[model samples]
Target: DKKVVLITGCSSGIGLSLAVRLASDPNKTFKVYATMRNLAKKERLLESVKGLHKDTLDILQMDVTDRQSILDARDRVVEKRVDILVCNAGVGLMGPLELQSLDTMRQILEVNLFGTIQTIQAFLPEMKAQGQGRILVTGSTGGLHGLPFNEVYCASKFAIEGACESLAVLLQHFNIHVSLIECGPVNTDFLVNLQKVELGDTSLEQLDTHTLGLYEKYLQHCDSVFQNAAQDTEDIVKVFLDAIQSPSPLFRYFTSGVVPPLTQLKITQPDGSQCIRSMSKIIFSSEEK
Candidate 1:
């Protein structure tokens, strides 16, 4: 039987790539329900899939922040059971914390933390009854360690880590696996889609000059990192495939293969000060170390 998989945020990036890969599987191993918040944006997903994968793929409209939409998507599943659930829908918010409004911060949490939890909540009962399932969440390095201007974004991802870890402990008893695919910068539209306070914007006019200087440096650092280190979405999908195929999948899979050096520092240096200093040097220092 083809494993029934439902993935959120299939409009683009890792989610789109994963959906395309699974739907195009030569062995026909998976039946994919690739969902996005806006079906209007599905043309890109469809275009990427190219040739017909009629039997293996279905596109559904699902707004992760809306409980009714999640439930509606679940109800539309012809198989009535999701063997694998991928909660990959999330957004990013960047800028100094002081510039962030309550509504903007709430929007980030709504989609990144609460949306993920809600998606899992909708599917948990059925998975429990089935006595076997896989839950894969798209996590971030920001979650493991903080970033300079991504305070709200990091908060949301960190919350997801907590939620997933708590669920993993209990779900193991039900033969269900919860895995977090921790990603670093990836070649995606995330930079374009994120809510950012740009330099010279009217909003920045009232902000302090020191903060403004740092923000400019952060932006440069961000561009350099993406140009030099961002992985393709295909690379991320491979890690997801490994997790899905494993009989005993690990709780966390780093897309870069091992914990990044900076992220590792957090574990080795529990004091937290060292990690902060290192990150500050990397982003704020005029010269890259």
Candidate 2:
């Protein structure tokens, strides 16, 4: 029996890569329902998954932020049963806290935090009845190690971490596996999606020079880090495969390189001050620090 795998946010990035990889599997182990918010944006996904076993893949419209959309997509799946559910649909928000609007923050929470919870809630009961399932969330290292100017984004991911942790223990009773893929900078459209609050924003008009200066430095630091260490979309897809195939999946899968040390700061130091100082230094020059 082919595992019925449903993934959200397949318009681009990790979601698209994972959907294509699984659908095109030579062994045809997975029957994939690759979903995105808009069907029009699915051209890239369509092109990429072409020539695969036709019956193995189906693209659907699902907006994680919209309850009705998710329900509609779920109903379309055969038997209303999902063997594997990947909550990969998320939006990114970045900028100075004050400069960011309340609406933007709420939208971020809506799409990234509540949106994920809603998707799981919609499908969890069926999994409970089936007595077996896997939930893989596309979490971020930002959830583990907070970064300057990314407070809103970090808040959303951190909440997800807590939710997934709580669910992991409870789901174990039903033989359901849950994992959070705590990825670092992946070379994806994610960066483009980040609301560069400082860029082309009239709101930054009132911010002081010192604050804007820090933002400029933050942007440069971010660029340098991503340029030097960002992983490919395929790299993350491989990790996703490992988690899906494992009989006993771990709770978290972090992208390789820089994240481990950063995420371990609290455990290693016990005091939060070291992590604070480290991030501060990275975001600002030594003199500014």
> lDDT per prediction?
0.95, 0.90
Show model 1 residue runs off by greater than 4 Å. Answer: 287-289
Worst 10 residues of 1 by lDDT: 280-289
lDDT (tens digit, per residue) of candidate 1 on 1-289: 9999999999989999999999999999999999999999999999998958999999999999999999999999999999999999989998988889999999999999999999999999999999999999999999999998999999999999999999999999999999999999999989888999988679898889888888899999999999999999999999999999998999999999999988899999999988988999999876434
Q: TM-scores of all models?
A: 0.98, 0.97
- Clashing residue pairs in candidate 2 are none
Give lDDT for model 1: 0.95
lDDT per residue for candidate 2 within 129-152, as digits (tens), equals: 999999999999888889888999
Give the C-alpha miss distance for residue 282 in model 2, angstroms.
2.1
User: What is residue 217's positional error in candidate 1, in angstroms?
Assistant: 0.4
Q: What CA RMSD would you report for each candidate?
A: 1.3, 1.3
